[model samples]
Target: MNTVIDAHNISKVYNPTTIPVYAVNNVHLHLQKGEFTALVGPSGSGKTTLLNMIGGLDRPDEGNIFINGIDITKLSANELISFRLQNIGFVFQSFNLIPVLTAKENVEFIMQLQKASKQQREERVKTLFAQIGLQDKLNERPSRLSGGQQQRVAVARALASRPQFVLADEPTANLDTKSAFNLLDIMAKLNMEENITFLFSTHDQRVIDRARRVITLVDGRIVQDTAEVSTQHEEAAAVKT
Candidate 1:
Protein backbone atom coordinates (compact mmCIF):
# COMPACT_ATOMS: atom_id res chain seq x y z
CA MET A 1 0.00 0.00 0.00
CA ASN A 2 1.08 3.58 -0.61
CA THR A 3 0.94 5.13 2.84
CA VAL A 4 0.06 8.78 2.69
CA ILE A 5 -0.17 9.43 6.44
CA ASP A 6 2.00 7.86 9.11
CA ALA A 7 1.55 9.04 12.70
CA HIS A 8 3.65 7.45 15.40
CA ASN A 9 3.24 7.56 19.15
CA ILE A 10 1.52 10.91 18.93
CA SER A 11 0.14 12.67 21.97
CA LYS A 12 -1.61 15.94 22.69
CA VAL A 13 -1.86 17.13 26.22
CA TYR A 14 -4.03 19.95 27.40
CA ASN A 15 -3.50 22.10 30.55
CA PRO A 16 -0.22 20.35 31.09
CA THR A 17 0.74 22.34 34.15
CA THR A 18 -2.63 22.12 35.80
CA ILE A 19 -5.32 19.49 35.18
CA PRO A 20 -3.25 17.58 32.62
CA VAL A 21 -5.75 16.05 30.24
CA TYR A 22 -4.57 13.74 27.57
CA ALA A 23 -6.49 14.54 24.44
CA VAL A 24 -4.55 11.94 22.50
CA ASN A 25 -2.20 9.43 23.98
CA ASN A 26 0.47 7.57 22.12
CA VAL A 27 -1.73 6.95 19.10
CA HIS A 28 -0.34 5.35 15.99
CA LEU A 29 -2.28 5.70 12.76
CA HIS A 30 -1.45 5.01 9.14
CA LEU A 31 -3.62 5.85 6.17
CA GLN A 32 -3.05 4.52 2.68
CA LYS A 33 -3.91 6.17 -0.61
CA GLY A 34 -7.45 5.78 -1.95
CA GLU A 35 -8.93 4.54 1.34
CA PHE A 36 -12.21 5.88 2.70
CA THR A 37 -11.97 5.72 6.47
CA ALA A 38 -14.01 7.08 9.35
CA LEU A 39 -12.65 7.98 12.73
CA VAL A 40 -15.54 7.43 15.10
CA GLY A 41 -15.63 8.39 18.72
CA PRO A 42 -17.81 9.95 21.34
CA SER A 43 -17.34 13.63 22.15
CA GLY A 44 -14.08 14.25 24.09
CA SER A 45 -12.56 11.10 22.62
CA GLY A 46 -9.79 13.12 20.95
CA LYS A 47 -10.65 12.25 17.36
CA THR A 48 -10.68 15.89 16.27
CA THR A 49 -7.43 16.55 18.09
CA LEU A 50 -5.83 13.66 16.24
CA LEU A 51 -7.15 14.85 12.91
CA ASN A 52 -5.93 18.40 13.49
CA MET A 53 -2.49 17.11 14.36
CA ILE A 54 -2.35 15.08 11.20
CA GLY A 55 -3.51 18.04 9.12
CA GLY A 56 -0.82 20.28 10.66
CA LEU A 57 -3.33 22.67 12.15
CA ASP A 58 -1.83 21.71 15.50
CA ARG A 59 1.30 19.92 16.56
CA PRO A 60 1.50 16.98 18.87
CA ASP A 61 3.05 17.50 22.28
CA GLU A 62 5.10 14.41 21.58
CA GLY A 63 5.85 12.12 18.63
CA ASN A 64 5.71 12.68 14.90
CA ILE A 65 3.38 12.93 11.93
CA PHE A 66 4.58 12.02 8.50
CA ILE A 67 2.60 12.92 5.40
CA ASN A 68 3.93 11.35 2.22
CA GLY A 69 7.09 10.52 4.17
CA ILE A 70 7.76 14.09 5.36
CA ASP A 71 7.83 14.61 9.13
CA ILE A 72 5.60 17.55 9.92
CA THR A 73 6.28 17.71 13.61
CA LYS A 74 9.65 19.32 13.01
CA LEU A 75 8.46 22.04 10.67
CA SER A 76 8.51 25.66 11.72
CA ALA A 77 5.18 27.51 12.08
CA ASN A 78 5.34 29.19 8.68
CA GLU A 79 6.67 26.06 7.01
CA LEU A 80 3.88 24.01 8.53
CA ILE A 81 1.26 26.37 7.09
CA SER A 82 2.87 26.15 3.66
CA PHE A 83 3.08 22.37 3.87
CA ARG A 84 -0.58 22.12 4.84
CA LEU A 85 -1.70 24.34 1.98
CA GLN A 86 0.03 22.03 -0.45
CA ASN A 87 -0.62 18.66 1.20
CA ILE A 88 -3.91 18.62 3.10
CA GLY A 89 -7.50 19.62 2.46
CA PHE A 90 -10.03 20.24 5.21
CA VAL A 91 -13.82 20.41 5.35
CA PHE A 92 -15.24 21.66 8.60
CA GLN A 93 -18.70 21.14 10.04
CA SER A 94 -19.59 24.83 9.82
CA PHE A 95 -19.11 25.07 6.03
CA ASN A 96 -16.49 27.84 6.33
CA LEU A 97 -17.04 29.46 2.96
CA ILE A 98 -16.19 33.10 2.47
CA PRO A 99 -19.49 34.97 2.68
CA VAL A 100 -18.92 37.26 -0.30
CA LEU A 101 -17.44 34.95 -2.93
CA THR A 102 -19.53 32.92 -5.31
CA ALA A 103 -19.14 29.15 -5.43
CA LYS A 104 -16.74 29.36 -8.36
CA GLU A 105 -14.60 32.04 -6.70
CA ASN A 106 -14.56 30.17 -3.38
CA VAL A 107 -13.19 27.07 -5.04
CA GLU A 108 -10.64 29.07 -7.00
CA PHE A 109 -9.38 30.96 -3.93
CA ILE A 110 -6.92 28.33 -2.74
CA MET A 111 -5.33 27.73 -6.09
CA GLN A 112 -4.82 31.46 -6.34
CA LEU A 113 -2.93 31.39 -3.04
CA GLN A 114 -0.81 28.59 -4.46
CA LYS A 115 0.03 30.96 -7.37
CA ALA A 116 -1.79 28.92 -9.99
CA SER A 117 -2.37 30.86 -13.21
CA LYS A 118 -5.78 32.39 -13.69
CA GLN A 119 -6.48 29.98 -16.52
CA GLN A 120 -5.39 27.03 -14.37
CA ARG A 121 -7.61 28.15 -11.51
CA GLU A 122 -10.60 28.77 -13.76
CA GLU A 123 -10.30 25.44 -15.53
CA ARG A 124 -9.91 23.47 -12.29
CA VAL A 125 -12.84 25.26 -10.66
CA LYS A 126 -15.08 24.44 -13.63
CA THR A 127 -14.02 20.81 -13.64
CA LEU A 128 -14.52 20.39 -9.89
CA PHE A 129 -17.87 22.19 -9.94
CA ALA A 130 -18.96 19.84 -12.70
CA GLN A 131 -17.74 16.81 -10.81
CA ILE A 132 -19.65 17.84 -7.70
CA GLY A 133 -22.79 18.41 -9.79
CA LEU A 134 -22.76 22.06 -8.81
CA GLN A 135 -21.98 23.59 -12.21
CA ASP A 136 -25.26 25.48 -12.22
CA LYS A 137 -24.61 26.93 -8.79
CA LEU A 138 -21.18 28.19 -9.73
CA ASN A 139 -22.21 31.82 -9.59
CA GLU A 140 -24.32 31.51 -6.46
CA ARG A 141 -23.06 32.70 -3.14
CA PRO A 142 -23.27 30.47 -0.05
CA SER A 143 -26.32 32.39 1.13
CA ARG A 144 -28.10 31.60 -2.11
CA LEU A 145 -27.64 27.84 -1.87
CA SER A 146 -29.16 25.12 0.23
CA GLY A 147 -27.18 23.47 3.02
CA GLY A 148 -26.30 20.58 0.76
CA GLN A 149 -25.22 22.80 -2.10
CA GLN A 150 -23.04 24.90 0.19
CA GLN A 151 -21.39 21.75 1.49
CA ARG A 152 -20.79 20.56 -2.04
CA VAL A 153 -19.03 23.85 -2.72
CA ALA A 154 -17.00 23.28 0.42
CA VAL A 155 -15.99 19.86 -0.88
CA ALA A 156 -14.96 21.38 -4.18
CA ARG A 157 -12.90 23.99 -2.35
CA ALA A 158 -11.22 21.25 -0.38
CA LEU A 159 -10.31 19.41 -3.58
CA ALA A 160 -9.18 22.49 -5.46
CA SER A 161 -5.65 22.29 -4.11
CA ARG A 162 -5.22 18.70 -5.32
CA PRO A 163 -4.01 17.62 -1.92
CA GLN A 164 -2.98 14.10 -1.02
CA PHE A 165 -6.04 13.55 1.16
CA VAL A 166 -9.15 15.26 2.51
CA LEU A 167 -9.92 15.56 6.21
CA ALA A 168 -13.58 16.12 6.97
CA ASP A 169 -14.61 16.94 10.52
CA GLU A 170 -18.29 16.21 11.09
CA PRO A 171 -19.13 17.37 7.59
CA THR A 172 -22.66 15.96 7.71
CA ALA A 173 -23.55 17.36 11.10
CA ASN A 174 -25.42 20.42 9.89
CA LEU A 175 -27.50 18.80 7.17
CA ASP A 176 -30.78 16.91 7.18
CA THR A 177 -30.91 13.20 6.40
CA LYS A 178 -31.44 13.68 2.68
CA SER A 179 -28.69 16.24 2.36
CA ALA A 180 -26.29 14.09 4.35
CA PHE A 181 -26.92 11.11 2.13
CA ASN A 182 -26.51 13.18 -1.01
CA LEU A 183 -23.19 14.53 0.21
CA LEU A 184 -21.99 11.06 1.07
CA ASP A 185 -22.95 9.80 -2.37
CA ILE A 186 -20.92 12.50 -4.07
CA MET A 187 -17.91 11.83 -1.81
CA ALA A 188 -18.09 8.07 -2.35
CA LYS A 189 -18.29 8.49 -6.10
CA LEU A 190 -15.29 10.76 -6.05
CA ASN A 191 -13.34 8.34 -3.93
CA MET A 192 -14.09 5.41 -6.21
CA GLU A 193 -13.57 7.15 -9.52
CA GLU A 194 -10.78 9.58 -8.73
CA ASN A 195 -8.80 7.50 -6.22
CA ILE A 196 -9.11 10.28 -3.65
CA THR A 197 -8.38 9.40 -0.06
CA PHE A 198 -10.70 10.72 2.67
CA LEU A 199 -10.46 10.50 6.43
CA PHE A 200 -13.54 11.67 8.24
CA SER A 201 -13.84 12.56 11.91
CA THR A 202 -17.53 12.06 12.47
CA HIS A 203 -20.17 10.57 14.70
CA ASP A 204 -22.85 10.53 12.03
CA GLN A 205 -24.09 7.04 11.28
CA ARG A 206 -24.67 8.03 7.69
CA VAL A 207 -20.99 8.78 7.25
CA ILE A 208 -19.92 5.73 9.24
CA ASP A 209 -22.11 3.39 7.22
CA ARG A 210 -20.55 4.50 3.93
CA ALA A 211 -16.94 4.24 5.01
CA ARG A 212 -14.83 1.34 3.75
CA ARG A 213 -13.06 1.19 7.09
CA VAL A 214 -14.31 2.19 10.54
CA ILE A 215 -11.95 3.05 13.35
CA THR A 216 -13.24 3.52 16.86
CA LEU A 217 -11.45 5.74 19.32
CA VAL A 218 -12.26 5.85 23.01
CA ASP A 219 -10.57 7.97 25.65
CA GLY A 220 -7.91 9.05 23.17
CA ARG A 221 -7.02 5.55 22.13
CA ILE A 222 -7.98 3.42 19.13
CA VAL A 223 -10.13 0.57 20.34
CA GLN A 224 -11.17 -1.02 17.05
CA ASP A 225 -10.03 -0.96 13.46
CA THR A 226 -12.38 -2.73 11.07
CA ALA A 227 -12.37 -2.81 7.30
CA GLU A 228 -14.71 -4.41 4.82
CA VAL A 229 -13.07 -7.56 3.57
CA SER A 230 -13.27 -8.43 -0.09
CA THR A 231 -13.63 -12.02 -1.29
CA GLN A 232 -9.95 -12.24 -2.08
CA HIS A 233 -8.94 -11.03 1.36
CA GLU A 234 -11.30 -13.47 3.06
CA GLU A 235 -9.99 -16.37 1.00
CA ALA A 236 -6.38 -15.46 1.62
CA ALA A 237 -6.93 -15.21 5.37
CA ALA A 238 -8.63 -18.59 5.37
CA VAL A 239 -5.68 -20.14 3.54
CA LYS A 240 -3.14 -18.60 5.91
CA THR A 241 -5.03 -19.72 8.99
Candidate 2:
Protein backbone atom coordinates (compact mmCIF):
# COMPACT_ATOMS: atom_id res chain seq x y z
CA MET A 1 0.00 0.00 0.00
CA ASN A 2 1.11 3.53 -0.70
CA THR A 3 1.99 5.76 2.21
CA VAL A 4 -0.89 8.16 2.74
CA ILE A 5 0.54 10.19 5.59
CA ASP A 6 4.05 10.71 7.03
CA ALA A 7 5.03 12.61 10.10
CA HIS A 8 8.71 13.09 10.93
CA ASN A 9 9.84 14.11 14.40
CA ILE A 10 6.61 15.91 15.06
CA SER A 11 6.18 17.91 18.23
CA LYS A 12 3.67 20.36 19.65
CA VAL A 13 3.85 22.35 22.84
CA TYR A 14 1.86 24.95 24.72
CA ASN A 15 3.04 27.65 27.18
CA PRO A 16 6.70 27.15 26.48
CA THR A 17 7.93 29.87 28.78
CA THR A 18 5.48 29.32 31.59
CA ILE A 19 4.21 25.92 32.74
CA PRO A 20 5.44 24.27 29.58
CA VAL A 21 3.46 21.30 28.36
CA TYR A 22 4.18 19.10 25.44
CA ALA A 23 0.93 18.08 23.86
CA VAL A 24 2.88 15.86 21.48
CA ASN A 25 6.52 15.05 21.95
CA ASN A 26 8.96 14.09 19.22
CA VAL A 27 6.69 11.46 17.79
CA HIS A 28 6.68 9.91 14.34
CA LEU A 29 4.00 7.86 12.69
CA HIS A 30 2.65 7.01 9.27
CA LEU A 31 -0.39 5.46 7.63
CA GLN A 32 -0.85 3.64 4.37
CA LYS A 33 -3.69 3.44 1.92
CA GLY A 34 -6.58 1.17 2.95
CA GLU A 35 -5.13 0.71 6.43
CA PHE A 36 -7.29 0.56 9.57
CA THR A 37 -5.40 1.63 12.66
CA ALA A 38 -6.25 2.66 16.20
CA LEU A 39 -4.24 5.18 18.19
CA VAL A 40 -4.79 3.99 21.77
CA GLY A 41 -3.66 5.97 24.76
CA PRO A 42 -4.68 7.29 28.12
CA SER A 43 -6.15 10.74 28.62
CA GLY A 44 -3.75 13.53 27.53
CA SER A 45 -1.61 10.99 25.74
CA GLY A 46 -1.37 13.28 22.67
CA LYS A 47 -3.60 11.24 20.38
CA THR A 48 -5.81 14.18 19.52
CA THR A 49 -2.84 16.50 19.12
CA LEU A 50 -1.17 14.16 16.68
CA LEU A 51 -4.45 13.79 14.78
CA ASN A 52 -4.98 17.54 14.58
CA MET A 53 -1.56 17.99 13.04
CA ILE A 54 -2.09 15.26 10.50
CA GLY A 55 -5.51 16.66 9.56
CA GLY A 56 -4.04 20.16 9.15
CA LEU A 57 -6.25 21.56 11.91
CA ASP A 58 -3.06 22.53 13.73
CA ARG A 59 0.60 22.92 12.85
CA PRO A 60 3.36 21.33 14.84
CA ASP A 61 5.94 23.62 16.35
CA GLU A 62 8.66 21.39 15.02
CA GLY A 63 9.04 18.57 12.45
CA ASN A 64 7.45 17.97 9.09
CA ILE A 65 4.16 16.47 7.97
CA PHE A 66 3.71 15.11 4.51
CA ILE A 67 0.42 13.80 3.12
CA ASN A 68 0.42 12.08 -0.25
CA GLY A 69 4.05 13.16 -0.56
CA ILE A 70 3.09 16.81 -0.29
CA ASP A 71 4.92 18.60 2.50
CA ILE A 72 1.93 20.04 4.33
CA THR A 73 4.24 21.68 6.82
CA LYS A 74 5.35 24.14 4.18
CA LEU A 75 1.88 25.23 3.14
CA SER A 76 0.50 28.57 4.25
CA ALA A 77 -2.60 28.72 6.42
CA ASN A 78 -4.93 29.27 3.46
CA GLU A 79 -3.13 26.68 1.40
CA LEU A 80 -3.22 24.16 4.23
CA ILE A 81 -6.95 24.68 4.68
CA SER A 82 -7.54 24.09 0.98
CA PHE A 83 -5.27 21.09 0.91
CA ARG A 84 -6.99 19.55 3.93
CA LEU A 85 -10.44 19.96 2.41
CA GLN A 86 -9.29 18.22 -0.72
CA ASN A 87 -7.41 15.39 0.99
CA ILE A 88 -8.40 14.71 4.61
CA GLY A 89 -11.71 14.07 6.37
CA PHE A 90 -12.40 14.50 10.07
CA VAL A 91 -15.00 13.03 12.47
CA PHE A 92 -14.81 14.81 15.80
CA GLN A 93 -16.01 13.30 19.10
CA SER A 94 -19.08 15.49 18.87
CA PHE A 95 -21.21 14.79 15.81
CA ASN A 96 -21.05 18.51 14.83
CA LEU A 97 -24.00 18.11 12.49
CA ILE A 98 -26.07 21.12 11.68
CA PRO A 99 -29.31 20.93 13.65
CA VAL A 100 -31.52 22.11 10.81
CA LEU A 101 -30.10 19.92 8.10
CA THR A 102 -31.45 16.46 7.45
CA ALA A 103 -29.14 13.48 7.20
CA LYS A 104 -28.86 13.81 3.44
CA GLU A 105 -28.13 17.51 3.63
CA ASN A 106 -25.53 17.03 6.31
CA VAL A 107 -23.71 14.51 4.14
CA GLU A 108 -24.06 16.75 1.11
CA PHE A 109 -22.56 19.73 2.90
CA ILE A 110 -18.93 18.89 2.11
CA MET A 111 -19.61 17.93 -1.48
CA GLN A 112 -21.37 21.24 -1.87
CA LEU A 113 -18.26 22.99 -0.58
CA GLN A 114 -16.25 21.13 -3.20
CA LYS A 115 -18.70 22.37 -5.85
CA ALA A 116 -19.71 18.84 -6.73
CA SER A 117 -22.84 18.50 -8.83
CA LYS A 118 -26.14 17.70 -7.19
CA GLN A 119 -26.37 14.37 -8.97
CA GLN A 120 -22.90 13.34 -7.83
CA ARG A 121 -23.54 14.37 -4.24
CA GLU A 122 -26.88 12.53 -4.17
CA GLU A 123 -25.33 9.41 -5.63
CA ARG A 124 -22.51 9.34 -3.12
CA VAL A 125 -24.78 10.05 -0.14
CA LYS A 126 -27.24 7.36 -1.23
CA THR A 127 -24.54 4.74 -1.61
CA LEU A 128 -22.78 5.62 1.67
CA PHE A 129 -26.03 5.72 3.69
CA ALA A 130 -27.09 2.35 2.29
CA GLN A 131 -23.71 0.83 3.08
CA ILE A 132 -23.91 2.10 6.67
CA GLY A 133 -27.54 0.92 7.08
CA LEU A 134 -28.97 4.40 7.32
CA GLN A 135 -30.98 4.46 4.10
CA ASP A 136 -34.28 4.92 5.88
CA LYS A 137 -33.08 7.83 8.02
CA LEU A 138 -31.97 9.92 5.07
CA ASN A 139 -34.60 12.54 5.71
CA GLU A 140 -34.23 12.61 9.49
CA ARG A 141 -32.39 15.47 11.14
CA PRO A 142 -29.73 14.87 13.76
CA SER A 143 -32.15 15.86 16.50
CA ARG A 144 -34.52 13.11 15.42
CA LEU A 145 -31.85 10.43 15.14
CA SER A 146 -30.26 8.47 17.97
CA GLY A 147 -26.65 9.10 18.92
CA GLY A 148 -25.44 6.11 16.93
CA GLN A 149 -27.49 7.15 13.92
CA GLN A 150 -26.03 10.64 14.09
CA GLN A 151 -22.49 9.23 14.33
CA ARG A 152 -23.13 7.05 11.29
CA VAL A 153 -24.36 10.10 9.43
CA ALA A 154 -21.22 11.93 10.50
CA VAL A 155 -19.13 9.12 9.05
CA ALA A 156 -21.06 9.40 5.81
CA ARG A 157 -20.42 13.13 5.77
CA ALA A 158 -16.71 12.51 6.25
CA LEU A 159 -16.73 10.53 3.03
CA ALA A 160 -18.61 13.22 1.15
CA SER A 161 -15.43 14.77 -0.23
CA ARG A 162 -13.97 11.35 -0.98
CA PRO A 163 -10.92 12.07 1.12
CA GLN A 164 -7.91 9.80 1.05
CA PHE A 165 -8.27 9.09 4.78
CA VAL A 166 -10.66 9.73 7.67
CA LEU A 167 -9.55 10.77 11.14
CA ALA A 168 -12.01 9.90 13.89
CA ASP A 169 -11.44 11.05 17.47
CA GLU A 170 -13.06 8.72 20.02
CA PRO A 171 -15.82 7.92 17.54
CA THR A 172 -17.69 5.47 19.80
CA ALA A 173 -17.31 7.27 23.10
CA ASN A 174 -20.95 8.29 23.41
CA LEU A 175 -22.61 5.12 22.14
CA ASP A 176 -24.14 2.14 23.91
CA THR A 177 -22.71 -1.35 23.46
CA LYS A 178 -25.03 -2.28 20.60
CA SER A 179 -24.47 1.06 18.92
CA ALA A 180 -20.72 0.77 19.30
CA PHE A 181 -20.67 -2.67 17.75
CA ASN A 182 -22.91 -1.54 14.92
CA LEU A 183 -20.71 1.47 14.20
CA LEU A 184 -17.59 -0.67 14.36
CA ASP A 185 -19.12 -3.15 11.94
CA ILE A 186 -19.77 -0.40 9.44
CA MET A 187 -16.28 1.03 9.84
CA ALA A 188 -14.56 -2.32 9.57
CA LYS A 189 -16.62 -3.32 6.57
CA LEU A 190 -15.80 -0.07 4.85
CA ASN A 191 -12.12 -0.70 5.48
CA MET A 192 -12.25 -4.25 4.14
CA GLU A 193 -14.63 -3.83 1.22
CA GLU A 194 -14.36 -0.23 0.07
CA ASN A 195 -10.66 0.13 1.05
CA ILE A 196 -11.42 3.31 2.95
CA THR A 197 -8.49 4.27 5.14
CA PHE A 198 -9.31 5.04 8.77
CA LEU A 199 -7.07 6.24 11.60
CA PHE A 200 -8.97 6.82 14.80
CA SER A 201 -8.02 7.63 18.39
CA THR A 202 -9.95 5.36 20.68
CA HIS A 203 -9.75 4.09 24.25
CA ASP A 204 -12.49 1.46 23.81
CA GLN A 205 -11.17 -2.05 24.13
CA ARG A 206 -13.60 -3.28 21.50
CA VAL A 207 -12.38 -0.71 19.03
CA ILE A 208 -8.78 -1.49 19.88
CA ASP A 209 -9.33 -5.18 19.27
CA ARG A 210 -10.89 -4.50 15.90
CA ALA A 211 -7.99 -2.43 14.64
CA ARG A 212 -5.52 -4.16 12.32
CA ARG A 213 -2.77 -1.94 13.68
CA VAL A 214 -2.62 -0.67 17.24
CA ILE A 215 -0.32 2.18 18.14
CA THR A 216 0.04 2.98 21.81
CA LEU A 217 1.03 6.44 22.91
CA VAL A 218 2.14 7.38 26.40
CA ASP A 219 2.71 10.85 27.68
CA GLY A 220 2.94 12.24 24.13
CA ARG A 221 5.37 9.57 22.93
CA ILE A 222 4.83 6.36 21.04
CA VAL A 223 5.71 3.47 23.33
CA GLN A 224 4.50 0.62 21.22
CA ASP A 225 3.58 0.11 17.59
CA THR A 226 1.96 -3.12 16.45
CA ALA A 227 1.24 -3.63 12.78
CA GLU A 228 0.53 -6.48 10.37
CA VAL A 229 -1.76 -8.21 12.83
CA SER A 230 -3.69 -11.20 11.60
CA THR A 231 -7.37 -11.10 10.78
CA GLN A 232 -9.31 -9.92 13.82
CA HIS A 233 -12.47 -11.94 13.21
CA GLU A 234 -11.99 -14.04 16.33
CA GLU A 235 -11.06 -11.04 18.40
CA ALA A 236 -14.11 -9.18 17.23
CA ALA A 237 -16.31 -12.12 18.18
CA ALA A 238 -14.74 -12.29 21.59
CA VAL A 239 -15.16 -8.56 22.11
CA LYS A 240 -18.91 -8.89 21.74
CA THR A 241 -18.90 -10.60 25.14
The top-ranked prediction according to lDDT is 1
Residue 217 CA displacement from its true place in model 2, Å = 0.5
Clashing pairs in 1: none
CA deviation > 4 Å runs, candidate 1:
227-236
Deviation in angstroms for 18 in model 1?
Answer: 2.1
TM-score to true structure, per model: 0.95, 0.93
lDDT of each: 0.93, 0.91
- lDDT (Cα) of model 1: 0.93
lDDT per residue for candidate 2 within 128-225, as digits (tens), equals 99988999999998999999999999998888898999999999999998998999999999999989999999999999999989999999999888
RMSD, each candidate, Å? 2.1, 5.5
What is residue 198's positional error in candidate 1, in angstroms?
A: 0.1
List clash counts for every candidate, in order: 0, 0
Where model 2 places Cα greater than 4 Å from the true spot, the runs are 228-241
In angstroms, give how far residue 190 of model 2 lies from its true place: 0.6
- Candidate achieving the largest TM-score: 1
- Compared with the true structure, model 1 gives a TM-score of 0.95
Residue 14 alpha-carbon offset, candidate 2, angstroms: 1.2
